[model samples]
Target: MTALAALVDFWDEEIDRWVSGHAGVSDRLQPWFESYRGRGHGEVRLDAFPEPYTGRLIGNSTPVVMLGLNPGAAVPRFQAPGGVFFEQLKTLRYSEWAATVPYASKEWESIAGPNRFYQNRFAFARRLLGEPNWSIANGVYFELYPYHSSGVNASMEPPGDVIREFVLDPIGDLDTQHVFAFGKPWFSVPARIGLPPGRVLSAKWEIPSREARIYSLPSGQDLIVMAQNGYAGPPGAGDTEALARAIGLR
Candidate 1:
C-alpha cells in the first residue's frame, strides 16, 4: 500500500492503545484525535502524549529512519508564532497532553523552545550530512526529516535490548538504511555493531557488521568509531566541499 495509507492504519491501531494505558490522557482528547485531519504544522512531537504521536506518525510519511532519542520537550506544537493561526489553539489545553505543552499564553515559550531544537537539529544534520545548501535553494530550512520516537519520556527508558526487539527491529527491514543516533544513550546497539550512529542496520541486531562510521559534531573529531580511524578535523573552506562529496550530494 502507499505510505500515507500505511501510516493511517498504523496510527489507528496503535495510538488508542497508548492513550488507554497512559493515565494523563483525558476524555476530551478523543475528539481532537478524531477531528484532527492533519492541520497546522506537519512535524509531530513524540512526547508522552499518545494522541499527537500516533496522529502524526500515522498521518505523515515514514521518515528515513527515525533518529532514536528520549522524547524532547522542545518539540514544536501547532500554536507556534509567525505562522497563520498562531496561538489559535493556545487558550485550550488538550487533556491528553502534558500541561507543559503549549497552551494559550504559553505559545511564545513553546514556539521558542522547540524552534531552537528544530533549527539546531536541522542545521547540525545538514552540516553533518553535507547538505548545507539544501535549504538555500528551496527558500526554506534543511530539517532532519525522519527522526521518530514515543516522545520525551526519560522515565520510560527502554533498555537497548527492548528497543531492538520492538521499535528498531521492525523498521530496520524497510529500504531505508541509517538510523542516526543522537547521543551515547541511543548509540549503544549501533555502536556495538560497528554501524554508524545514523546509518541502516539489519532487521536483527546480530548482523555481522558494515562500514558505518560514527563521527562527532562541528569537527568530526576524536575517534568516532571504536577503531581509531582518522580524525575528522574542523571544517575548512575546502572541507565543506569535501564533506558534500563524501555524502555524494555535492
Candidate 2:
C-alpha cells in the first residue's frame, strides 16, 4: 500500500484500539469519526489522541524552519496561520499527540492565540511580506510529559527510546530546508529526531543602542535558534532578525 493508505490504516487501527480502551468510547467517538471521514480530499486526519485535526500538515513540502516546545496540555501546542501553508512533507508518530494523553484548556488557553506565539510569528512574517502565510512545526512531543503535549510544565527528561518510538520514527525520512528551534528547552529535540543541527543565536536584541555584530556561519544551511521570552519584538525576537540579517535575507 501507498504511504497515505498506510497512514490512514495505521491511524484508524490505532484509534480503534484507543477507543476500545475506554468504556462507551465507540458511542462517543463514532460521530467524530464519521464527520472526519465525510470531508473530501482526506483533509482531516486523526491526531494521536484520535482528535480531529483540520490542518493539512502532512504532504511533501519541506519546512524552512521548525519550532518546538515541551509537551503540555495547557497551551496551544499546534496552531498554524491560515492560507496556503506548506505540505506535511513527512509524518511523525508520538503518543503525546494521542487522545490517551491528558489534555486540559488551562494551559492551552494561556498562550499561543491571536497575540501570543502565533501572532508573534505572524507579525514577523508580515514584516517580511505584507501578510503572514507560513507553517510551523508546532506538534511537539515533550521529552518527559509525553501525554501533556499542549501546555507548560517542568520535568527533567524522559528516556530517549520513548522519544524515538513515538516521534523520531515517523519523521525519520522527511526532508526540511532548515530547523529553527524556538528556545533552549527545545533546541535538542529536533536534532535528536535527525532533522538538522539548528544553531543557537542571541536574545540580546533589546534597546541596547550598541552595535551588535552579525556573525555569519560558514555554511549556507541557514539554521537558527530563538527564545520565546515574551519579548515585544519579532518571532525569534532580536535573535531572529539577527539571523535573518546575517543570512542577508533581511
* Highest TM-score model number: 2
Per-residue accuracy of model 2 over 1-250 as CA lDDT, tens digit each: 4433344445555544544443123553343233212123222223333332211234536423333443223222342211011011112232223322122223334443233544455446444332345433332121222222333333323334433443333333234333344544444444444545543343346544322222122233433444444331335345445555654565
TM-score, candidate 1, is: 0.38
In candidate 2, what residue range of length 10 has the lowest lDDT sum?
81-90
Compute the lDDT of residue 141 as modeled in candidate 1.
13
Model 1 lDDT, full chain set: 0.33
lDDT (C-alpha, whole model) for all candidates: 0.33, 0.35
Number of colliding residue pairs in each model: 12, 19
Please provide TM-scores, in order, for all candidate models, with all chains considered together: 0.38, 0.44
Instruction: Provide the lowest-lDDT 10-residue window in model 1.
Output: 136-145
